[model samples]
Target: MSTQVLSPPVAAVRLEQVTKRYGSGPAAVTALRGIDLALPRGAFTAVMGPSGSGKSTFLHCAAGLDQPTSGSVWLGDTDISRLKPRALTVFRRDHVGFVFQAYNLLPALSVEQNITLPLLLAGRGADPGWLDFVTGAVGLADLRGRRPSELSGGQQQRVAIARALVTRPDAVFADEPTGALDSRTGRQVLELLRRTAEELGQTVVMVTHDPIAASYADRVLFLADGAFVGHLDRPSAQQVADHMTHLGEW
Candidate 1:
């Protein structure tokens, strides 16, 4: 008998020569300049760039919120760049998670209801045990019945995080998730996000301008003039700030 080693799993997210452009001809504005990236599962990565660096465009393209003008994007083994609009919408609902600065929650829904909304939209019944686990993971076990209006900003954001995790999505994309919180609360949220990646084996990709927020990630990738310029591993806030200073003005 012959023994063979199995290959490792595909990247949680991969982008190959991805580019984006708005308009055409002389008036065209190119956002991404052939970005290539691969992020593994159970990793926390942060993206930082100065103003007009294509950070938002990169996130949108990677998250399937917008199509790339060229190249390919893969979510695990699926070529999401080729999916049609409706199929892409369904795929994103079932496979991808999002956390935004605004804490986009439904006012009429309870915390638990909001968290399970993705599963509802997917027409899949929430597993009670899994639901319980996700709520507990985000420290919302006791506040499951509260409405969004009844919660504090931090609590509401926690609900959003729990909601993002409920689908057990392949990757969670966070756009300035701590932007609206005070320093102390923002620290708490960042810690929770790190824990989600470390303890749950989830892949997290965050885009932010704050050095302190970016420092929470395992690695910080820098962008400039629409391309990935460099990266730092396990960087400190001061290091990130100094690098940004060198990258030029915000």
Candidate 2:
């Protein structure tokens, strides 16, 4: 009988010895150390840290929004750190999705238009079926005709979520996605994000400061002083808050 060899599954996102520095010399500041990480497919991971702990820098490098000074960032098999500016831009547009706290939507475009804008920017026509599926998934099917200005805060954020999912990208990076919403509305958004991972088998990475928000993730990775300090799996909000309190003065 021939033996069947099984290879390990490729990571949805991988960072190898990644480092980021702001300047060249004496006044330079290192934002990230030689960090390494690999996030599995369908995993919902949260990154948390105190102020100036490099959370933003980590997200920027991992999402290909910024290049690393050394090492490589891989979205699946592609080493995004090596791509030229134009190619990187194209790759980010087609393969990565982002949701920020600002809910960056065009006031003039209808909800449906905002959701499909990514495809339009990529020069690809939106597939009607897929567009409908995305809008419905985010609970915007009924509100498709309304402009961003006409929607409530929660509804607008849902539109942003729909836009991020429209591309069906390999990974979605959310930075304080619910920062602008009230606690109740924030929970709704977080639940939507959790479902995006559970039901759709999508990889999600969120950077946030709220312990309650981090509790929604499968695991929470803590960073301090430009390096990973610790992590907790399926921890309670109180547990996460206790851990954060010990990291340093807030």
Candidate 3:
């Protein structure tokens, strides 16, 4: 296999001419159309698009949760898209964390247990300092003993965030993390996600439909029909809304 040389600046996450198609020939539905992206270290980026615009596909491919049909995905020095299944699994377990629209916590597990699930699954125990820091950062220190059933929607999402950060991942992929919560709680979760990127020097790529949520990111990348068409830095909520609206209307 020919080696692909990655860039020297060391982006925490990136995609180069990546594409994904659901079928072959005339039946094929191209989800992504040879897109490129670079997510800098310690930055928070939001991905915005309407439904079926490949927002989720991009995030999944970047996170190694799914493979692209062609091109490359680089995580730090490694081309995660090229790793074999076991290696990819290890890389994702060791370096990548993810947040989804659903809390997806084990209902039987307490907040603390749920937070440590990934680590435990990898045959590692929790680190007290990381546990303390993430839980405290998410303002869930007192709720560790509580189960998912007992927490509010926002609180559960905070637990999910804590779980994602417990391993100090190189980067995180979050898809509609605040979608399941109300506006007030959603803002709180977004703030915590922002803090995670800023204070911890972690990279984050989030897919969000809400411009308010997108505004929390340091940069916003807008997509239409599975391509990277535009970007904005330090975008305001209004700016994000305007850009997304124009993309939809285009």
TM-score of each: 0.97, 0.98, 0.94
Highest lDDT model number: 1
lDDT by residue (126-219, candidate 2, tens digit) is 9899888878878898999999999989999999888888888889999999999999999999999999999988999999999999999999
Candidate 1 to truth, TM: 0.97
Ranking by lDDT: 1, 2, 3
Inter-residue clash pairs, candidate 2: none
Model 3: lDDT of residue 113:
98
Root-mean-square deviation (CA) per prediction: 1.4, 1.3, 4.3
What's the lDDT for residue 157 in model 1? Answer: 96
**lDDT per residue (tens digit) for residues 130-202 in model 1:** 9999999989999999999999899999999999999999999999999999999999999999999999999
Q: Please give, for residues 46-131, the per-residue lDDT of candidate 3 as tens digits.
A: 99998899999999999999999999999988999999999999989888989988989999999999999989989999989889
